[model samples]
Target: MNKKSNAVLRLIGILLLTIAFCVLGYLNAKNIKLGLDLNGGVSITYQTVEENPTAEQMSDTVYKLQMKAQSYSTEAQVYQEGKNRINIDIPGATDANEILAELGEPGTLQFADEDGNVLLTGDDVKTATAGMTNQNNNREYVIELHFTEAGATKFAEATKNNVGKRIFIIYNNEVISSPNVKEAITGGQASISPIESYEQAQKIASTIRIGALPVSLTELRSNVIGATLGAEAISTSLQAAAIGIALVMLFMLCVYRIPGLAASLALFMYVGLEMVLMQAFEVTLTLPGIAGIILSIGMAVDANVIIFTRIKEEIGAGNSVEKAIKSGFEKALSAILDGNITTLIAAAVLYIRGSGTVKGFATTLAIGIIISLITALFVTRGLLTAFFALGATNPKLYGIKKETKVINFIGFRRIAYSISSLVIIVGFIFLAMNKKNTGDIFNYDLDFKGGSSTTITFDKDLSMMEIDSEVIPLFTAATGGNASTQAAKVAGTNEVIIKTRTMTTEERTKLYDSLQEKFSISEDKIVTENISGAVSTEMKKDAVWALLIAIFCMLIYIWIRFTDIKFASASVMALSHDVLITVTFYAVLRWAVGSNFIACILTIVGYSINATIVIFDRIRENLHNGSKKKGLEYVVNEAISSTVTRSINTSLTTFISVFVLYIFGVSSIRDFTLPLMVGIVAGAWSSVCIAGPLWFDFVILSKRKKEQLSKK
Candidate 1:
């Protein structure tokens, strides 16, 4: 085919693929499940009554709970929280009482003789499931049971001796069914028939499954999440995201002009493809996950920004547009790979080791990175090529690369190090003071600390702002300002659920009376619950371990790729610097450290490492190209100077997206986005200033030490 004909065909192919993804994404959008935090649901935490439960016991309990939860909904999640606590989250469930009633106790199941002598216990039962059987040409529900070898032998003996006698199936000390033994059955399989309905059979099956729990459990906390809260959050978040994305697209087009327009088109494809993948993979979308997606959108743009900048530089160097495009993508490949790989490493570790919403955040981030890579490297490149072929060859439209001088980054390395150290030390001091004042290292919210949640129905609907200003003050004053409050207004209703530190009886009464007097809420419309902390001590340990592992993994990857411990060490230090600074913001500001806090911290780690990698990639390239001809200081300075614009531009775009989220989002979302914005700035600073200089110092000192050793 002619060159023009080939270009037309490729463009048509790209258009078709884009249209297919859009259609698929739209069709599967409804299949994406919103997590409990986004949609009203029942969140229940159970503590093992058995003291010092073993890992196996905890695992068994969690598995049983997961099975029980699955009976409630396919999207239900059951996972261990702390050492001996299990958290069950059932999305789309609004009635806490109903869920509790249906779940019942994690009671033991036993087979007994007529006199109530126990023959076998639930431990003997291998599996139980609800099944349908044909009886007398009618469909009847039944519970199919399978037993272990020992249990089967015992059951056979019992049935043989008790033929024509009645045996009772008992649960929680209550006789559920008694059937006469007809024969000495030697088989391990049996069936409980004559069940009235499938629902009842399924309930019995679930109960039987619960019998596998090696230890008993006590309800630590139960929460009834209103669906309206999540629905409204989704609506507001979507609106904000739409607006932010539109602004980003406009900015890209106006700045890069034609090339920027091509990137904008590619970004749309990335979004559509990401949505379709989320639905196909059944990844849960939580509020934090949405934040992750927004962050990754900025990252997606960063890749394009790097490529475009390189293209501009090549064109300025007097290369043809086609040649510049090829060279630009080639030159940008190393930086893009290193940056995305580092971030991907963090996401992978988080997904493997993190739990609950942390996993969701990691999953979304990983998906976003992968999709962004595809779109940026292939989709955007193809589209840009097509546009150029169709007559977008103006160098001015693509942007001109201005000549720039290298800044002496090494000369000011000490000052940068001192400033970063001072900030970090101050952050630690704030944490120490916070620990002393509050008896906790940070201001942990209800999700991290067991608290009392009060749901109050007012005569009139109140906005979150009104509740914060009018009602929260009453609670704060009552608790001597020691209480932290989080309130969410139930959508389509005048009810709000307010969570605060555990309240005494007197405090509860005082708060109820105050609400009644202030808002004229009826006594009958108010309800209070003592909720267990979602992040148990063990869960916190897991989170810490996950982070450590992530950092270690990134270190190994950098060392292997760069073949230098200095680069790896510098990168990790930069990541730690970003995290500590962000943590300081939380501590000094006394921000409520909740579930989202974990997501925020991990995000900073990923983002900071990405920025660090970009600079380091440039340094490695310069080192390889310059060899020993260039001094360490010159190489480091040049590397930093070359990538400084990228660091600033990427950070600015990411900050803009998150800043918009904070501005337009609700209180909970604002809390998440605020810290994220700070982290983005910190990551950028460390990448441009700290990472390169630190590596330079390491290289310079090492060489000097080698020379001294040679003299010796």
Candidate 2:
């Protein structure tokens, strides 16, 4: 490798550029964001029921409703809320009343018999579709009927003999219009004429054209969100994130000194890059979203480890200062990309299927992966590469050592194996023993329990006593009549969330009717949201399957990319460790400090696994390419040392970002950010000390012994 002028100079230029970005980020740390989930803000999704309509139809209705509603007032910002819910964030509109009235303009179609007696109601029609045609030489937007053949046949018989008689179309218990039927049409088809505008004609055609819902939906969960907790959460996370970042930086300086400073500088760039990626990709920064960013800090350190270790190795390999810098990065590049790439694949899979907070995790994680790779591979490596190019050749000055690559990890297998086994076993036992106390398993959250919550934010604060005595009790009598509050909006104010462990469709309706009376809203304003057991079960299954599949996909990727089973197996095992340890931590935390534990576990799983994979990717290279005389032991040592700094740097930077979130972020974020911070530390330790070394001690050494014994 050339150690001279041009090649070395290029390396210096890149390093300086990366350094500049870090300077910029450090200056802007105060502006970084923390998601609401981490900070305890209520995220409510209000979906208008299908009323026997499709998702597309419901969305269309919501779009129009928002415009119509806004016409009444301009305070509504509409978004596509969960499933079919419409999210309307109205600033200062505590009533949330006028918004509902605009959305729920009743389109009930009352079907009357020959003597004008009602035969059925809009409740009987499931759905309707509309189109255009020329009727009796007049062009009209024709509404077509798709009814339950029963609804269709009765209408056909009624219209067959009354071809020229006026057939009244009463909606909302009022006569909309009456048109004489020119012909009797069968096969569940019908048309109405002289409708309002083309838009209104389409609306009426679609509304009156459809069939009825199987059962009326009532709001089972509705309550004003408490702003009190949100404020507290905001205060808590920001402080934790700040403390965490400072601690990691302090540790790096203590351990690596000059190199540590360089890595920290690199870390700053990583954060800046990560934010740009998140915005460029349009990732929503939710509670789990902050977890991803903070966790990414760890993964980013992993790349730094790879490069730092390689730099150390090249120096040991007897290269000139410049040559060593170039070679170290060249050797470590493949490993850095391989590791981050694998975790990246998992993040991608998650984003595609995960909804709500899950999507947030995947999105931020994926962004972290991309930027982590960029900084570690290009920015950090290029900067280091440039540093050597600038003619700075004091091995002592840069902290290059005479004996850095001689550490042995293969001899510590017994201890590692024993400790790992104990941790895994303890985790399983703890999970099993306390399964009943855990959420969903024991006292599931409303997500699985199938309920609704409405957070009413008054223009001013209200008394909890009044709400409990009036609002909650009214809803309790309405929601399954066994109204229970799993967790009221601990965030005080006029806000609250009402919940029930279970409620059927009828029970939900009755609950809504009761709340309408108590909240002083029209019956229509008390919108209903029903949660079905089947849908809940499916969502549960999907969540589990998605995680498992992500793990499996990652396993196969490591095996195929590295062309070895041992490497992949070790990686999978280490990942399993990260996940289990995370869960154990969560259980202990939740058991002790009542935080949202599951988010922490999931965030840890993703963070740790990414670290392990990156380290393993680097180790595989030393196995395949390093000189053989030094044997597997040397190769393993070389691999670990070569990637060690990258790991440390990645982990440190990731922790720094996480620390920032934990401190400066919010309470909602702390539940996730704090655990994630712990998990990052654990994940780093496991990947370097556990996963990387274990592979050589067991598989590499075992193969050598079998060969020796077979020689006989």
Q: Highest TM-score: give the candidate number.
A: 1
Model 1 lDDT per residue over 128-190, tens place: 878899988999999887889998998899899899998888889877767788888889988
- For candidate 1, give the lDDT: 0.81
Off by over 4 Å in 2: 1-266, 385-391, 404-408, 435-536, 588-599, 614-619, 625-667, 688-712
TM-score of each: 0.78, 0.60
Candidate 1 lands at a TM-score of 0.78
Give the poorly placed runs of model 1, Cα more than 4 Å off.
43-87, 93-214, 218-225, 228-230, 455-497, 504-506, 518-527
Worst 10 residues of 2 by lDDT: 214-223
Model 2 over residues 209-236: C-alpha lDDT tens digits? Answer: 3213222223222223333234444445
